[model samples]
Target: MIRSLKEEIYKFIHQKNSLYGLVALVLLMIYSALTSKTNADSLISVFGAIEWIPIILIAIGSAFFAMEYSNNTILLLLYKNSERSKIYIAKFLTILLYGIVLATTSIITALLLSIVLKSRQYNLFTVIAGKTILIQLGLNILGMIIYSLFAVAMSFMLIMLIRVNAVVICIGLAWGFFGTSLSTALMKTLPTISNILKWNPLNMVFISQQLSKPHYYRVSQLSNLQLIMGTLFYSLLFAILGYLLFRRRRV
Candidate 1:
């Protein structure tokens, strides 16, 4: 397992997509910071780049696996490792690691931009929406991590099933961008079962919103703890399904 993980990490580090993704994320943070209209907007913009984490993870994770099959390197990987489970887990972990790197970059870039652009507006200790900026930033980061896990796992499952990177990227991006809105629309259209529907994986993506704005609980119809658990459950579920498909797939 350790050897497989090391190999996966090495591959991820050498991938051009990894560097391009990082650069794109940083540029997004700069754009968000520059376009803020007020102090509150600026502060919120500090975490704005995080909203793109899921989309970025989906693209990178799906492309990583799809590249393996397209290049016929998956056969070499299986021949060398001989343990499909190890390879799958290692690849998943590496994707999660990339998510962590992106999240870290978002936070750091946001802070630097905030200092340069709005140093006098508010400090990290400044209170906003009843919580300090630093605390809100932490919660947002946690939410991004949870959502990224689900995004990466779901992309893996989709790629394993379809073996088409472009389709997988489109599906993953649609879910990442619209899943929460779709969940909200469904709940309103079926208010009677909104309670049950609130537990859906799509609604769990609102964990950050509820965590930062406690009043958002009315919209999500779920507590922060519930959203966290639901996101984790779906993440694990998709990961298991993806692994099963990968193991059964013919090289």
Candidate 2:
């Protein structure tokens, strides 16, 4: 199982498109580092601008799964003596690995940018040292991981229902965005809706960057157990949904 999983992961990393995307991301990092303004507003603008990574990640995650199945390579794997269970878990881990890679890229970009663009207003290094940055970075990475894996779940889920994975890929982004935007808004009239929003995987990803900073938003005096419990519930749902879909899938 480990060997099979490792082989698939290796294949995922070596794919021509994946390699190119990594290269593009690296180049962007360099560009960001060099082009960063030596001012405060520009520094804030840089971190704020990184939301694009999640959008790209969602598209990539969908394509990653769809490409395997649509191209018939995944079906071939089933014939290679590997169990569906192993493959399912492998795919899950691969998406998580992909998210980590991208999240690392984002962090590296930010760290380099912070060093180059460090200022009185954007003093990330001085304001936050090793422990602080580690905490903040953990939140950022954790948030991205959740969303990216959710993308993987989405990609697998949609590919089973639709023939073309690209359609799902396109719709996944829209769904993700819409899901995130409506989560909090819907909670108002529908008390249940509010409870449901807590499990929204994208919330931590979108708000992690801001929430790490104390002064930015008011630290609520009230506890939010619903949100915490909802996250756990939704995560379980994502796993079960993927298992059910792939277990019965033609692949």
Candidate 3:
């Protein structure tokens, strides 16, 4: 498993398009900071900005697995007697690692930019200390990582089932944004079932915000522990389904 993971990591790092996403994420963070009126404002902006990270994770996940099928690389691995389960697990771990790096980069970029472009009218020390900005930063980053993993599993499942990169991406984007919102809205109409919506992967989008700012517009129905557990369950469920489909796939 370790060797497979190393191999998967090597493949991911060597992909030319991988760096582009990271660069874009950093630029977005910087821009968000630049337009902010205060350090705390920038912090909030950065946190909101990272909300789109699940889409990024989906794109990467789709492309990563799609390439293997499209290039017939999976056949080559099987020819070499590689265990399918190990390959799937390695890819999962690799995507999780990628999410960690992306989240960390976002947090670091946001913090540095906030410090550099801080508003002169605002007392930086007071805002930072009062809000416990460092702790919030950690929570935000962790939340993004969790969301990214869930997205990775979802995209991987779609990719394995569809075996088409473009379709996978389209479905991922549509569901990540529109489908989730629609579900949330519909759930609200049924007050009794609304509470169960919190367990949906899409609704967990505000997990980090709920942790750092309970008063945020989109409050979570689940407690922090419940949210975390729900996310893990969704991720695990998608991963298991993805692997099962991959095993039975013609490729």
Find the candidate with the highest TM-score and give its number.
1
Query: How many clashing residue pairs are found in candidate 1?
Result: 0
Candidate 2 Cα errors over 4 Å, as ranges: 23-50, 118-122, 125-134, 191-229
Q: What Cα-based lDDT does every candidate model obtain?
A: 0.84, 0.58, 0.74
Candidate 1 clashing pairs?
Answer: none
Candidate 3 local lDDT, 1-251, one digit each (tens) = 89889989999999975797788778766665555554565575363455667777788888998888778898987776557899999998898788888877776776676667654554333445347655665666677778788889998899988888888878877866675466567668777977766676666665645566655435456777777788788888999999999889886
lDDT of 1 by residue, 201-241 (tens): 88877875567778888888888888889989999999999
**Model 2, residue 244: displacement in angstroms?**
1.5
Candidates sorted by TM-score, descending order?
1, 3, 2
Superposed by TM-score, candidate 1 places the C-alpha of residue 234 at a distance from the truth, in angstroms, of 0.4
Number of the top lDDT candidate: 1
In model 1, the Cα lDDT at residue 44 comes to 54
Alpha-carbon RMSD, candidate 1: 1.4
Candidate 3 regions with alpha-carbon error over 4 angstroms: 35-38, 44-49, 120-131, 216-218
| lDDT of model number 1 | 0.84
Against the true structure, what is each candidate's TM-score? Answer: 0.95, 0.73, 0.87
